[model samples]
Target: MSNDGHPMKGHRFVAWLIAAGIIAASPALADTPTGAARELATKTCAVLAARVDEIPGSGPVFLRSYDSSFGQGPTAEPALANAAFTYDNALAAIALTACGHRAHAQRIGEALLSAVNLDRAGTKGRLRNTYRAGAQTQRPIPPMGWWDVVASRWFEDPYQVGTATGNVAWAALALLTLSEVTGKTRFRDGAAVLAEWTVQHTRDGQGPDGFTGGVHGYDDAPQVLTWKSTEHNTDLVAVFDWLDRAGAPGDWSHQAKAARAFLDAVWDEASGHFFVGTTPDGVTVNRAVSSLDVQLWPLLLHGALERWQRSLTYAEGAHAVDGGFDFNDDRDGLWVEGTAQAALAFRAVGRATDADRLLAEVAKELSPSGYIWATRQPSISTGLAIGPSSATDDFRYYRRPHLGATAWAAMAALSWNPFTGQRLQPVRVRTTGSK
Candidate 1:
């Protein structure tokens, strides 16, 4: 649990220096390369800091995933109110580490630990997709809910309370990052618990030979999801690899290999892109749609340049929108988070100019409230459903100030890779005849 290097020194010191005006401001705010990144990172930190738990020594806290002003009006998505998504919180934790706020980041990590140890269903190794935002109460942890005056009962969104493999992986990644930076065994142990649950519950030898979507619906009768996602598996590749290196008690190296196998299977060498994932059967490849994240995330892998370098070019040609990128290949409008992912991918590939251009576009997404918008349009579709009960592709992103988007922008600006807890390194080239 000893720190190998001071993660708190470099970026953290620089950010503090910037705040104190010790360094001259970069030219043309949000225009120059470093200026755009600095602007994004500074604004993101300001917004996130405002949401920190005010009380000293308070239990872990979850930052509300969106601004309160979002879920209003007749067309309101009320379920979002006070819902702290695990994915966003995880991203925020990693972003906080990059921004030099390890204490604040650890609070969020403590919240994830709460989720792990005190799940509402009393499950030992499970976490919901979302939890009630703010300071933690006693165990079993509370699920997100609000009073429904019309129904005269407390209502909770099924999707919010459910566990998704991708979200869980993200939480583990966040914990692993905190553990790495803080050298805290508890955070690493918590991540291992989540990874154990994933390997036990979701791993599949079905068509794709990877992990499944995870459980959905209510606790009493949770539906086991069978669909396998390239994105989710991509996440697992990193998680399992980290666990393997940590020498956790499991076949994590094998788990990582299986996840990589899935990634390799779904890779379309002819098309130069990855398929979305498998269908509900878990065996049949679901090539009906293409997603932006699936294309960009894999490029963060160590040997990505050797195997999937073309994916970067393929993503740009297909998903680029107004200098940003979209959630899906339809390219309906800009998805801020995905655009940030693309920026990091560009950075990973040593295309600094490409990264700078994408970042400049991302800088424009800064909302007046200091958070970034989820999307450029009023709404944008992802061609996916909210849950198993949904009949249509109702999943969409609104033009709301989003914690996830802001966190991603901060990571991109700081050149940090959420998966690795290190700055994004150029994709490694394998010498000929190398393993």
Candidate 2:
């Protein structure tokens, strides 16, 4: 975890130093997060931070939320709980693999594969909270209302639906990340399913202007509303980011076209921040309140920030105190859900200072027991203590994959590593007649 001789540091330094060189025609790569913040950003916080009590027969989970005293005894205790909702697990999967923990990544990958099945309707998996099958509700097409959180991951919706945000895109991203680590075609095949689902189901929720928000079109009806928001923008774009990264065959360039079209349509030509879902009242919204979606877009697409340049309103206020993000607005200071997303965003646009500023705050709040403080309130056991600090608190994202997905959190941090593609150590292969 300390400064060591490695390629990641170099990569980190390069990304962090980007702004000093641009203000002209779109360069090949402009805003890249670099330096220690860049390096540490991608490193995984050991799972020792937070601890949780699991049910005897229940599946393991990463607890995102927990009690301060956490147990019957008034002692300052810790326990693993649940996985985070977003592609948070993906962050850990990528970083762990990057740091040479391919085996651990594979284990997490298996858990992910077992968690949900997107196969044909007759043979699908069940939703985490509800009993309805994942295949039934998430197939042939995606149900749009699934992203609404409280909608219940599973319910006999008789109507069927999917959450477009992480639901539609993460399957592909996770599969791709797995493929990169293990080079397995099955993972790629799964990723393909993700691609097909989004390609066809795209218009399911999108309105006339292209960008969309809300449940899938009710029985493929006419475009009833034109809503715009970060969730709509990022999920759709990520589907393209995957296709782009997956190197899928055929002339599917239209995905990018679709991506850009949607981006331009909803890009607020004025202020930067993506709004809350577009309202039925045609309200104007552009605030710094955007969620993980805003951060993921640019991080996934190198030239994505340029989409903002077309109007001079893309994260303009960025680099501000909160790096233009409002993590502080929530009262718990930096966090796993919100700030982690912001960390990804900051790294994407080469905001090393901002990335560090945010991480530094979070790191300071981390407990030595390996738990990133679950929250900055109540017991002061925020449970997210894995950054640049040496604090102790046994409430880490590990041990709880169901509700607390630390894998992706770890991955996002490691992605900021200065040395992503290269191995820190040497590897040798046997030749036709060697050894």
Candidate 2 residues lying further than 4 Å off, grouped into runs, are 1-45, 48-86, 114-164, 202-228, 249-252, 280-296, 307-324, 327-337, 367-369, 374-409, 417-435
Q: Across residues 1-435, which tens digit of lDDT does each residue of candidate 1 receive? A: 002113243346446546755233222123324467776666566556555634356569888888766422222456777788999999999988777777778899998987887676767779999887888866877877788889899887888888999999999999999989988878889999999899999999977789999999887788999999999999999998888787777888888988988998898989899998999999999988889999988888655645576887888888888878889888999898999999898898789888888887887776555567788777888999988999999898887778999899888988888878887778675533211
Error of 1 at 72 (Å): 8.4
**C-alpha TM-scores of all predictions:** 0.90, 0.56
lDDT of 1 at 347: 90
The prediction achieving the highest lDDT against the true structure is 1
Q: After superposition, how far is residue 275 of candidate 2 from its true place, in Å?
A: 3.6
The TM-score leader among the candidates is 1
Residue range 1-435, candidate 2, lDDT tens digits = 112223354345334334322112112112324553333333223341112222122232222332232322232221112213324344444444554555544544454454445422332431121122112222322321222347545322221232333353554555566776687866655556555544554443334233433333223342323345545555555555455556766334556456545554455545554443444432344343433335344334434554443211233233123322332223332234445445545555556455566554433323322334433333222222221122553322321112222333443455432112222111122222200
